[model samples]
Target: MFQGRLVQGYDFVDGDTDPSEVGAPYVNPAYGHGTHVSGIIALVAPEARIMPIRVLDENGEGDFWRIAEAIVWAANHGADVVNISFGYPQQTQLLRDLLDACSDGTTTTGKTFPEIGINRLFFSIAAGNSGDSTFIYPAADADDSNGSLAIGASTRFDRLAQFSTFHNRVKLVAPGENIVSAIPGDRYAFWSGTSMAAPIVSAVAALVKARYPNLNPVEIAERVEQTSVRISYGNPQIRINRVDALCAVTLIPPATCNP
Candidate 1:
């Protein structure tokens, strides 16, 4: 469990940094999931500050109310970029409205997300590792023309990973297969999933935001997507923009991202 760090959790998490470590007779299986995602973000953007907000237990089950609460907290607490490497297949209106608030500055009902010193937040969401063209909530919002970036897993060869969900909902792809990042017990591990691809895009959004401070949250996300390397393997119409940090920061045109 990651102790001595800024961690806030729901009631189900108790006081333990990792909810998986709280129960006595049983520990949550994904003990280092949060740290692992945070490590990827840190690895990509070392200077960016991160706030670890726990909304789900180790079993990957979460309440949409709590998740919405956490998103509101981060938006008001100086967090301009949020990386959610988790999602469910079920679609709900609660998260859909909240995700819109992150980029629209207000909800459809006119409720505000209350930003700190920058534009509304940007969300990097996992496109699920189901290996099929299935829909994952929140990330499924990628098709809604918002600041949320739905990222899928890609192999080292830049080809879509077998386990990655490729479809119109997936807006981008990144290195998710055999990804190495920090795990629990002060160690590291190699894991592969669309979950691993999301944070990489989050950090790239941070870099782009840092490079162009004036860009809005939607604009920052757009810049990254606009400069990504198109794999040319996905559908001819549905773009599968692969995230490129250097190209995003340099504002390289997507047309010139040829290998």
Candidate 2:
């Protein structure tokens, strides 16, 4: 109802980029799922710009190609942090190639564009909404140590959500369940699952980028992981603190002076 008025959305294209044609119905009558997630990210980093990339359709299905294009576009368009709040069940090597290609600091389109010179384009994707222990697509797609970041879900109790799939692939964990954020029509909603968790990390990443503009995507992730507050979850340990992202931006000179 409030697409352009209070909120903005993106068109997830199946083929290549197009200026027109974007229509997809939501599985849930509520069409604010992506808006809600994007809002949370903006909330944490109120100063950071939010880019709406609609990879998934109204039915909640997105192909690998669409996702790849979104990543490339965000990089080309000067987005410091790209948050992917959803994942699929299938694996695609082509997607992995795209992610790696983007992080390598080259234009995948092969058509030369003016240099944006953004230090790094980090991809922060949800670990997966499934409660199962198995790995999820895209998140699991980090078969190698690519520059992308895969985040898991944690509750306010600081416990891992049963539905959030976890593995070594998950770089960090954050609040996911019942998270309150913006939605379509300027409404606010509380959502669950790893989907909610991914954006929290994205917001933090934005904070990091804003503070330490020189740090690249990989450096930002390293700082977040290294400075994170560690927690335990039975057999597997998780990171709860999103690395004091605000501090990363606010407090860099002191560390550098001492170093």
Candidate 3:
């Protein structure tokens, strides 16, 4: 379930590995964040194909360049939706340029939409785990910059994670805490953080795209955001509903009666 392996770039400042040979298999022993996130996405979009692009390594770390390259690769390949659950603490020019390229349909690998179709390439990123109101890199990055979706994590109760970053850049929140999903080597586990929450929304985006391929990424993102089921906290426990997602995809219209 892992994102495959780190192919190049990431190296610990203390390690002896060369940047040229940074790619590493994402097997167990190391924390399997990608595995859990990938499973959540697969669960929501059972019909969609997943491209396991490795950007992180065994140390639970990676190179900004490698991540940027992975984004470009996903766009160039036949990836209908690209889910990036990881991000760096600081923004680099190269990273920003890469994200911009992905959103604007320009990249080293190739353009996403022109080669595919308008709005065909969708970029969904985690809002980051930092507990702050300020926006974080990549997620806070302008939408038109690459026409992407920036997602924050919420509890199963639909309350924003105290640690989840809140900003104008945050479009929506989804289940992230204690989310259950697959691990490396045919295992499963539960993990917390916005990292896990992003894919749920991403998978929903994919479902909408798959069912209605004519809709562009911007259209789909707008639909999901505008249709989110907002539940208030402090009084009672709030939560997200599958029906909310169904409604976002327009499968179930608002105010519909249940049999």
Order the numbered candidates by lDDT, best leading: 1, 2, 3
Q: Compared to the true structure, candidate 2 yields what TM-score?
A: 0.79
Better of 1 and 2 by lDDT: 1
For candidate 1, write residues 28-131 as lDDT tens digits.
65567777888888888877667777777766677887788777767767777888888877888878877776777566666554533334788899999889
lDDT (Cα, tens digit) per residue for candidate 3, span 4-102: 332232223333344322324445333667667778888887766766665566566777756666565565665667777877667676655555554
Model 3, TM vs. native: 0.75
Model 3 ranges with Cα > 4 A deviation: 1-30, 104-120, 142-145, 233-243, 251-259
Model 1 misplacement above 4 A = 1-12, 15-27, 108-119, 232-238
RMSD to native, candidate 1: 3.4
- lDDT (C-alpha, whole model) for all candidates: 0.77, 0.66, 0.65
Report the C-alpha lDDT of model 2 over 1-259, residue by residue, as the tens digit. Answer: 2233222335664443432224332544325677777678777777777666667655566677777666666777777777777776777766766655555554345533233344357777888877765787788765224457778887777777777788778767778889998765556877887888888877787788776787776676666655555555766443344434544555544344222
Report RMSD (Å) for each prediction in the order shown: 3.4, 5.3, 6.6
- For TM-score, the strongest prediction is 1
Q: TM-score ranking from best to worst?
A: 1, 2, 3
Candidate 2 Cα lDDT to native: 0.66
